[model samples]
Every structure is written in C-alpha cells, then in structure tokens.
Target: MTIKSNTRPVASAARDFLLTDSDFSRVRALIYQRAGIALGEQKREMVYSRLSRRLRELGMSDFTSYLAQLEAQHDSAEWQSFTNALTTNLTAFFREAHHFPLLAEHVKTCAQPVTIWCSAASTGEEPYSIAMTLIEALGNRAGNASVIATDIDTQVLEKAATGIYTMEQVSKLPQERLKRFFLKGSGARAGQVRIRPEVAAMVKFGQLNLLAPQWGLKEPFDAIFCRNVMIYFDKPTQNRILQRFEPLMKPHGLLFAGHSENFSYASQPFRLRGQTVYELDAKRGKGVA
Candidate 1:
C-alpha cells in the first residue's frame, strides 16, 4: 500500500513596484495635464510612495495595471486619491511674513472695497493670513473686505472650509492675531483651534484648478496671492497659468508669487513691480461674464 501524499503551494512576497520609464512618463503627463505639476527624476520615490497607495487602495497589485485603469476609467476614485495624496500642503499662519506688510500697504492705497484672491491656498492659512492682514489694516473698516480662496485639492479645501487647525499648525501666528481670531480647544478638543466666524466669514474656500478652462470668478480681484505654487510646474505650464491670471486681475492690481518663482517667460501684460510681485498693465477685462 502507498502512503497518501499531501502538498501545499508556497506564497510569494508582495511585489515591489519599480516604476519603469514609460510608467514615469505616463504619470508625469497625467499629473501635468490635470494639476499642472511636473515631476523630475528626483521625485521617483515620491511618485512610487504616493501612487502606490492608490494602487493598494484600488486593489491593484501593480503600477502598470493601476495606470491602465487611471487612463480607461472616466471616474476613478484612485485618480482622485492620487491627486489628494500627491499635493504638497506646506503652509502655516503668517507664512513668508513679508507679504502681510505689502498687503497692508496695498489695502491702504485702495479707497474702494478690497477683493483678494488667495490662489493655491493650502489648508486655508494663506487666505486666513490675508484676512488677518486686512483686519489689521482696515481695523474698524475690516467689513469692507473679502478673500476668495481657491485650490485644486478638494480634500484640503474641505479641511480649510472647516477652519480648524492643530496647535502646532497655528504656532506661527502672532500672539495678538491668535487671541483675536481663533478659539483654543478644550479637554476633548485639545491641540486644536477654531477660527472665529468673523474671520472665517471673510474667507470663501472652494475647489479651483488653475488649469481649468475658466476661473469662474465674478469679480476681478484687487490683489492675487499665488505664492509657492508655480515651483511644481514646468516653464510652459507656468507661463500658461500666469497668462490666465493676468486678465482676471484689476489693472494695477498686485500679483504675488513664491519667492523662488518668477514670471520671466510671461507676456508683456504683467510688469515686474517688486521682489515677488507683478503689476497688471493689460486693458481691464470683464469678470466671469
């Protein structure tokens, strides 16, 4: 008689996703077209770590298959998650401190109501900073201002709209502004603060892609804060985005960008007026009509 035989198959370890050149190119193109960001070879690990999460979330075991789904599926949650995961949200209250004084000066020069656009407002700090600046500038006159804050990242926008931030996040805020505009958390709410309604009301947060066909603004702004955003874009994308912003600014309106960003290739519509600011010289155009 022969003894019965028992056999079991061995399982393999999880596959490591090594991005191929084509995979890199595909993801770069997709992110560029949708979010206006350019990834250099240096960001290989960033692409892998960020995009790998999307693959895992969608139950895709490989980057190749995940990318195929990203291309074919018109409404894929993976694509949305990829965008949310990849965006850089480096921000804090009173960031790049110099900008506040400039904003105060601009507000002082204007006799009319002020409309400020905080483009690329990550998690709401920049727009909130603008509001605080206006509050300091306008004082009792603060009611005459509003900030239109927009960003392409919906996840960040939602967090921004809530106007809640961790204590570490608000640590950079000036003491007076912190006391005046924010409410510190209690027991269960430790390590958090909520923006006071008056300050929060002054800002309107929404989702806006700088690459969109139209900006959908009903009024041209007196000042546009697009700081620290263009660094991720290539030169051509940067030029195109700057061109779109030009017409939306009021004539002589100030355009602020990242300290590292410059409009060297931009059209003659804007003239360099300061270290990181541009002045709109083009003929004024109607807003959102």
Candidate 2:
C-alpha cells in the first residue's frame, strides 16, 4: 500500500500579531530585556511569527495585550514561554570541534584547579565535552576540573541535568567515549542513555541572565566559552556583557566566543590570541588563585 501526501497549507492566525510595528517594538524589547537579543527592523515579521503562539496560548486577542501582561507580571511563567519562543538554540555535541583540541592542550599545561564556564551551555553538551576533554588531558587529575554550565532558559537546563538522551543525540560521540561515559537504558527506559555519575558531577548548571549587572559567581574561571550567544545582542549590550565578563576571568585565562563574535571593541583588556579566542591581559591581577 502507498500513502499519498496532502499539500494543502494549514490555516494559521500566526500573522495576526505581527501586522503592526507597535506590536513588533514591544516584542523586541521583551526579548532584549530577557535575553539581550536585539530584533532589527527586518525582524518585525520574524517576531510576529515567533510570538503569535503566546497570543493563542494566553487566550489574548493580540500581541499588545499579551506583551502588557508580560510586563505587568514581576516574574511569570510566561517569561519562559517568551524566551522559549524567541531564543534560537542551535547546538550539538562537539560543535566547532577545533575548540575541544584547544581545550585539551590548555588543560595539560595548567597546574592549578581548573574551572571552565560554558556560558551558553544549551542542553549541556558543551560542558560535558569540556569534562571529557579535561579527563582525557589530565587523566588522574580530572577530578580537579569543574565546569559551570549556564543559560537563561531554565527548561533546557532541567533536561541537561538529567543527562538522558536518545541515540541520535549521542551519535556524534566516539564509540569508546560513548561506552565510557554513558549508561545505556533498557526495558521501559529503552533507547536512552544517561551520562556516568562522575562525568555528570563535574558540571554545575544554573540560570543566568547575562544582562544583569551582577552575576552571582563566587570565583573566577580559568576559561570561558561564550560561543554562539553574542550574535543576538546589539553592540552596546555586547560591550556591556564583555565588560562584566572580563573581570571574572583569571589573568592569562582564555575566553572563547562564537565564530561570528569578536572582541575588537574590548581589545585593550583582552588580546585576541586566536580564532574567536581571547586571553586576559597580564595587567589584570592574578584572579581567584
């Protein structure tokens, strides 16, 4: 038997919220305040397309009232819905593979306890990759290495903490690494696997709004991976975020950004040492040793 596919477009009210510039502006601001993402003029339709679901879900008539409700609530579950709608989380295991080899090499030379921060650690693959790299490089000393994984989205973070994934999610991992680090599920838990307890323990996950003036980190990190996240912010907010993050890096510590992000504006404080990587200046004092 053969199945025939239907090509008729489904009816949608998705465009209803996006038809007005005023609605676009409100949405742009909400995204900026919540996630430091700037929606440009051309993004009016994109904003409308993304947020119309909230209008339907909240049973609101239009984007204006929905945005007003979002603003009125001091802290609401709607923010999660808003963020979930607006933010783009395109991440995979060992993406930008160059960075992992760089991490392994760097860890081999470090004498002190290493703490690496994966700033936009969506779903935890990056931090887990860091853990695996540190283990490979430092061997018996891997226990001394720690990774802090953060994102503004709490929903993904909860999933990251569980470290359970379908086979496809673990497909990129080498067979040996996969077998070493993941425990395969069976029976009712079939087709899923969880990270080994030791590897999972190396990471700490938390919610962070990078735009906030004060980040609650108690110690400086030896390295920071803020990759693929800065493209969303405007220049000023990007500069502000860099200013805030710079002080938290150890002198001579490494900072890695997305391939598209650059530190040219903040070059006086950090020297661009490699592709999307910067090093804190020697003038900065030894931080949190």
Candidate 3:
C-alpha cells in the first residue's frame, strides 16, 4: 500500500473529465466532514482515478457538475458511493499475525462468553480470523463467544456476509485451518472456498461509520480490533474516536491497533501494553466510569 505522492493527473490530455484543484479540495472537505478521513494532497491522482468511473457511470461530464449534484442532494445514495470509492480496504486472513496469538492469550483471561468487535472488518477476513482464534482458544466454550464485525462500506459488508473467498485468498492459511474452517467449493464454484457454517455463524456483520453521532451499540466488548483504520483520520479525529471507544469497552479491555499507529499521545485513558496494543490506563480505573 504505497501511496504515490505525485499529485499530477495520470495524463491530463487523455483524461475524459477535468479535475480542477477546487474539485479535489471539495472532495477532501466532503469526505472529511462525512467520514473523518483526512486526505493528503498526494491523493489527488488517486481521487481522480477513482471518481472518474463514477462520472462515467452517472453520465457526468465533469467533476464540477458531479460535485454540485452530490452537494445538492443531502440524502443522496451517491454519498455512500463517494465514501466507498475513496476508502482503502487492504486486508487479508491472519494479517499482522502476531496479534492473533496475543488475542488468544488475552481472551482466555476474560469472562466467559467473550465479545470482540472488529471495528474495521474489511471483507470478513479479520473477523473470521478472530472467530477462528476464539474457537481454538475456547474449544466447546467458543460457542458462547461472538465477533461483531462492522465496516462503513455497504458493498464490502455485503461481500463479507457471504463468507466466501477465492483460492488465492486462502492460500497462505495453514492447511489444518483451511480444512477445519472452510468448505471447498465444487464444479461452477471451483477455486473458491466458503467459511464453515459454524465459523460464519460466530460473526455478525453490519455497516457502521465511526464518525456517526450515535453508534447504537449496546454491548461492552472485551476487545476491539480497530487496526489500520485510524491512519486515515487526522489526530483530532483519532483522539475523538478513541474517546468514544473508551466507554464501550469493558474494564481492562484491550484495544488492538495497526503496527504503524501510536496512541501514547492520548495517555489519559490508554497505555501501550504491547506492539500496537492498548489497554485502559490503570489509573483511569475501570474504564471511563
């Protein structure tokens, strides 16, 4: 996931629609206001490349007209399309492998019927991985545990709920895990695997925007997997989200972050417990009561 810093259009002469600086700025503002994603100037080319397809599909000739139509319709379905377009969903099964072992060890100490939230569940891989880890850790008791997987993108969430993957997607997984957790597809569905019914039953998928005014989630979680999601947000937005997560977490609950993220700056409520892992500050005592 190397993002190119060059802001220049791929080929100005070859582009069908013109993306002026103003148009890009509007896009940046709109996305930030809606989803709290902070886009850098380097994303200019990426924005144009992604949004140009929208223009074509909508029969829009230029960014100006497209943006104007988007702004005028406050309840437009296009807004979701815009957010989904700009969102970067890079994920895989057992990504950042170290976290799973830590998770398995941590959940063993938590109360029975452990609840975990995969806050940025991209295409079901992370949540499924969590469910697999739980099954291995809790054995028969795993039936009582659950994983709540959520993403802001509806399209990806739909795909995630299907619990199916291409062979290439599951190639890196251990053969034992592949055999135990997934069913091999047949005939027309060859080369793809479907997650076992038991595994799929352990996870529940939903659409959630972290920036929403009311999250509506009632249960307190023993662990929250919000890895890599905060990188797209600015510092203020990140801090705000962490603040919101505090009350939803059970006492001594763990917060797993991406390898590149650091929450030490927000030391009032969280402290680094391991590599990119955070726990409620001991002094905070029982999580934001």
Candidate 4:
C-alpha cells in the first residue's frame, strides 16, 4: 500500500500525523457521501493540513484513529466538523457582478413575492449582495423579498449570519453604496462594518448539505445561486443536484453558477441564460409550458 504524499516518507518528525492513501480515500468518500464534495487526489496534502487541527483538537495522533472513532461513534456532529474542514469556501461580495442586474430586474418585475436561495452562502457576501440588489430595485418593498442563504459548513454560516466584515474586506464596494447598506462600527468595534438591520433582515441562514436526501424548503425560488461550489462535485452529483433544483425553481427562475463550472453537462434541466447563469428548461420538471 502506498502512503499519500502528504503523509508519506515520514518527511519530518515534526509532522504530528500521517494521512495514508487509505485515509485519504476513506475521508474523501465520506465527504462525498455527506456533502457531495469530490476532492481529487491533488487535494490530499491540502486536506491533511486542513483536518490535522481537527485531529489535534480531538487528541488523536493519526488519521486512522480519528476515522475509526468517527465510524464507531457514528458521530454526526463530528462528521460536520469533518465536512467543514474539507469544504473550500472562496467567495466575495458581488463576486460576479453581472448576475445581479438580471436578478434585480427579475425582482422588480416579480408580482409574486421573490425568493432567492444562496446555496453556498460562504461568509454571507453573496446573499447580502443579492439583498442590496433587491433593496435598490424594490426599495421599501425589498422587505417582501426572501433570501435563504445556506451552506454545509456551519462555521461559515455563523459568520455569514453575523453580517459583520472588516473595512478592508469590503473596501471594494463603492463608498456611497457601502454607507447606504452598512453600519460602520465605532470605538471598540472600529474598522468593521455590520450589514444594516434592513439588509441583514433580508437573509435567513441555515446549514444545508446539498447532497442530503430531503430539502425542506417549502417555496420554489425565483433565482438560485449555487455557484463556485459545484466545481468540487463530480459530474453525476452535479447533474443530480441540478435535477433536484428543477422542481424547486420557478419556470424562468435563473440559476447562477460559478465561473469555473459549466452547466452544459447538466443542460437537460437548465438552459444557459448568460455567462455562468442558467434558467430552468420550461419543458422540464414543473416549469411552465
């Protein structure tokens, strides 16, 4: 059996843990089963580094013991930590600015209450961006819009719900826009800004594993942002999730994808709307004919 590069050759005595090939394969499989994240072989080293601290916090010396304990305990909470550890979260406010314009247009025209789901909310920027766009379009009526921001990583969701960010973190936002939607901290909390109550009120955060069998959301969304996170999933998983999303979307509801993912592979259920944005096929699922 070959030891994985990240844990093999006993590279240094300073290394506290060993992540064997077996360990890598088992952990990756578990993550896929639990969260639909398909980490490739190249990620072995990265996973080792990310989860090593988890092992340390558990007082375990190696991956084998930690994994066995997980299996023996059927530790669902522990599994969440495992999922959070391996998931990659890279997001920004208005990360893909173009999508928001059409989204805003949709919200403005929507007679029915608008609902948007930020499927991989990651630290809250995207959902807040969605909220800001809705606010601009609907003004006081923005209260009628719904934004459900979710992620499998509860850690990030907690931070996302807080809606607080460093000035430097949000400096890219235009100054006037920033002042309009955010509350600048003072004194003890200087250098940070919190999403104003009205904007923060627009979003509701939850921990959702996309691969989970049942999605409890009652209402179909007008636009769904399941962006850059899909690149971590295999094609079949991606397609399955897209299919599941079909029934959960309005006929012309748009699906925003990440820059790195192309939904053509899952085109049966979604048709390209714009760059990395898709709309549910009218003929598929419950879409209007």
Candidate 5:
C-alpha cells in the first residue's frame, strides 16, 4: 500500500499585520492624490515599513484599518504624519557648491532688491547655504537680501525653521564661515550647532504643497532654487509645474534644478544657463534647443 502524500502546505501570513495587495493599492492612490508622490509597485514594502510605525502608534492592527482613518478625513493630523513618513529629506550644506558662486555673481549684478526662493528647504541646509553665500557675496549688505524657503513636509519645515544642526552636519563649512555663521552648543546641547541669528533671519519658512492650485507667492523671484524635487513627479506633472514656474520668475530669473532632473522636455521659457540651471527666456527658447 503505497500511499502518496496528498497534504498541501498552508501559506503563512506576514508577521505583525497583513499588508494585502488591496491595502497597497489603496495607499498608493491616497498618497499620490494628497502629495503627488508616485509610489510604484516596488514601494509596496517601503510603504508597509514606513507606515507600519504609524499603525503601531495609533494602535492599529492592520493597513486596512489605518488607511480607513486616513481616508475618512483628508484634512486630519494623521494626514500630516503620513506625508512626513513618506517624504524624503536627504540634504546637506552646500550640496551643490557651484550654484552658490553663480548665485553670488547674479546677486552682484541685480539692480532691484534680490529675492531668491529655496523651493526644497530640507532640514534648513539648502536655505542656510544660500544665506551664507549671500553674506559672503554682499558682506553686511546681505542682511537685506530676501530668501523664501518652502517645503511640503511640515515636520521638515519645523526643523528648518529652527536652523539647528548636528556638528557633523556643518562640517563641510570652512572654520571661519562656521565661526561667523553658527554658534557652538554647550552643556546638554553639546555636539550640536545652531545657525547664528543674523543668518537665520535672512530666510523665512513655510509649508507649501506644490501640487495645490494656488502657490501663494506674492511676487516674482529673481532666482528660484527648486533643486532635486522634480525627480519625484511624472513627465506631465513636471511639465505643468515648470509652466507654472515660468510666469513666476522675473525676465532673467534663474531656476536651479536637482542634479538628476532634465527640463528639455518641459521647460519652455527657460534656457540652459549652466549645469542644472536655467534662465528665463521670454520667447520660450523656441529656436534654441
């Protein structure tokens, strides 16, 4: 009696909470709608991992339950938590060093009051770098220069507004610049540094979701540092945002992009001025590629 084994192995569920396919799709759609972040299929695990902490914090047992709460009220505080969890904020002082020198040169020639916008103010680094550049370029006159820093993530905006950093964060800065622009922390705050009041005062911080219908910028800027942010959006989305930026800039305003982004397809009113930098062209660079 040769009895063949007909037993089927039972499938095991993932530990802690089950993140079903339905759950992932639901989450992907919601995040894209709220924040314009395109979460691909590969991000399923990342979404599960990042938002899992949120679930635990809210005593939620599964993604279904957690997402339900988020969907129920689009304007809830949980929405902020969800956005904060997903938004990537990897930045450092002088991430693009070359841009500052060009910026200093641009500021030197501006006839009107120079105004610049750091479109992605991640943890204060980029905006602070701009402030330092201006200070060096215009000396004490830099205090009068205007900088508006904005980010979609409220959590990062709060951190940026504080202008505080770890010692290692400012390590790239020259010793003289460090001593001039930042204060060394002591006692409980040792190993940390804070941007000096004067430098911090040069910029203002705000929460702005670029996907919104209205951007709330009152006047056109002389220079806009929208670095490294367009990589997250699809082509059409990128084109739409670029078109929106065109009218917002002065006749020859500069637009600085992230290293990985290319505006050849979307940029109409801007021409290549430097690597990842564009200058306003009223004729939309029609004849010039």
Candidate 6:
C-alpha cells in the first residue's frame, strides 16, 4: 500500500483574488515607476491586502485582470486610486516634538515672509503643526508665513484640506494650545474639532508626486519638512530626491527627516545639524545667516 500524502496545495482558494508572483512583481514595478516607492519582498502580503480592495470594488476576480486593465488605460483615473491605495499616511500633531523648536529658531533668522514645504502633508497634522509653530515663533509676523502641504495621495489631501479631526486625534495637545488653535465642535459634530480658520488659512494643500519631473513650484523655501517620507524610497531614489531638494531650499534651509532616517550616508549637499535635522553643507550654504 502506498503511504498517504501529507502535503497540501497552496491556499489560493482562501483568497478572494489570486495574486500570482507575476502580478505582485508588475504591481511593484508600476508603483515604483509612478510614485518612487520601493516595495520589498516582505510587503507582498500588504500589497495584496491593499490592492485586493480595489479589485473587489471593481468586481474583478484576479490580480492579473485588474493589473491588465490598469496598464491598458494610460490616462485612467484609476491610477490615482491605485496610488492612493498603496500610500501610507501616518502622522500626528507635533509627532517629532524637537523639530518644531529647531524650525522656530531657523525661521527667526530668515528674512520676512517665510515659506515652508511639507513634502508629505499626510492628513494635515504635520503642516498644521508647522503652522502653529510659526504662529508661536513669529507672533504677528505669522501672517506673512505660509505652509505648502502636499502628498502623493489625493484622497489624503482632500481630508487634509477639511482640517477637521476627532478629539482623540487632538487629545495629546495641551489645553492652552487646544483652545488657541482649534474650535471644539458640538451637537451633530461633537467629539470633533476643526482647525481655526486663521490656522487653516496658513496651509495650502496640494497633490504632488516626488517622482514627477516638474513640481511646478516657483518659490524656493526657507525650510523643507520632508520628514518621514524618504524612508519609503530606495537608496538611489533617496539620493535623487535629496539632490532635487538642494536647489529648492534657501542657503540656511533645514531638512527635517524621520527619527529613524539618517542622511549621513548621502552627505554631499546636507550635513547633520541636530538629531535627524539637516542643513546644507557649509561650502554650499554660504551667504545666508
């Protein structure tokens, strides 16, 4: 008698859509080409989970069919949905507490009419935090300051533009700041808070892709808060982005990165100023205080 087989088939039956290796590879390439995000091997499950919702919404049964449709339509709006689906928008108000103080000091030294670029606006928290800091630092002069908040995901930018947040989202803020900056809601909108009009006005939300050829921004910034964004890109992508950032920044401009990111490896245009904060190299940074 032959021994019974102990092995079983792979569990494609359990998944709503069959994501073959080929399908995942194509997705990885497409997103990298479009958005400059490098998906690693461990992200296969995450890629499948996020894209599966899109497939389900489109009534598709397999990744192959969905990806084929996506590839065929060069000018499809679905491309935005796909990019939005894969984007990770994690942020909180003053999440990196130290950076704000440094920014406050940096802007004080700059000329009037300060401008900042929050490269990954992400639900509006970071840019709003930057706005609040500018107000606190510059006081009445804050009227001349502005934040250009942008993200690759249009969906998040739409949410960011609303400037509303649940109480839970603002829970950690001090009572004084809460009263000063946000309007508490009531009745149907209880437990929600809307950013005050004055604070909201300081931020202009837009959609931008880091990989895009032209950012369409004419003004060079006094500071660029590209925080926590470069981690999603690979080394070459990071270098290219850092290179692009150099020309966009004022001589004394600061680049605040994520806590976990280190730019010392790419130390040509920037040097570590404090913690994850960077400033233009001294040789390249002359002429400005």
Question: Of the candidates shown, which would achieve the greatest TM-score relative to the real structure?
Answer: 3
Candidate 6 Cα misplacement greater than 4 A, ranges: 1-13, 282-289
Q: Cα RMSDs of all predictions?
A: 8.3, 7.4, 4.0, 2.5, 6.3, 4.7
- Supply the TM-score for candidate 2: 0.89
Tell me the TM-score of model 6. Answer: 0.94
Error of 4 at 89 (Å): 1.0
What TM-score does each of the candidates earn? 0.89, 0.89, 0.94, 0.94, 0.91, 0.94
Which residue pairs show backbone clashes in model 2?
Answer: none
- List per-prediction Cα lDDT, in the order shown: 0.81, 0.80, 0.90, 0.85, 0.83, 0.89
Report the error of model 4 at residue 163, Å. Answer: 1.0
Candidate 5 regions with alpha-carbon error over 4 angstroms: 1-14, 282-289
lDDT of 6 by residue, 1-289 (tens): 8543322212445776677777878899999999999989778888888999998898888888888999999799999999999999899999989999999999998888999999999899999999999999999999999999999999999999999999999999999999999999999999999999999999999999999999877677888898888889998899988888887778868899999888889845897899999998645754322
Q: Report the poorest 10 consecutive residues by lDDT, candidate 5.
A: 4-13
Residue pairs clashing in model 6 are none
**What's the CA error at residue 55 for candidate 4, in Å?**
1.4
| Candidate 1 residue-pair clash tally | 0
How much lDDT does candidate 5 score? 0.83
- Least accurate 10 contiguous residues by lDDT in model 1: 4-13
Q: Candidate 6 lDDT (Cα, whole model)? A: 0.89
Clash count for each candidate, listed in order shown: 0, 0, 0, 0, 1, 0
Worst lDDT run of 10 residues, candidate 4, spans 2-11
lDDT by residue for model 3 over 1-289, one digit each (tens)? 9554334444556778777777888899999999999999889889999999999999889898899999999899999999999999999999999999999998998888799999999899999999999999999999999999999998899999999999999999999999999999999999999999999999999999999999878788889999999999999899999988888888788899998998888635877788899887545535322
User: Model 3: what TM-score?
Assistant: 0.94
Which one is best on lDDT?
Answer: 3
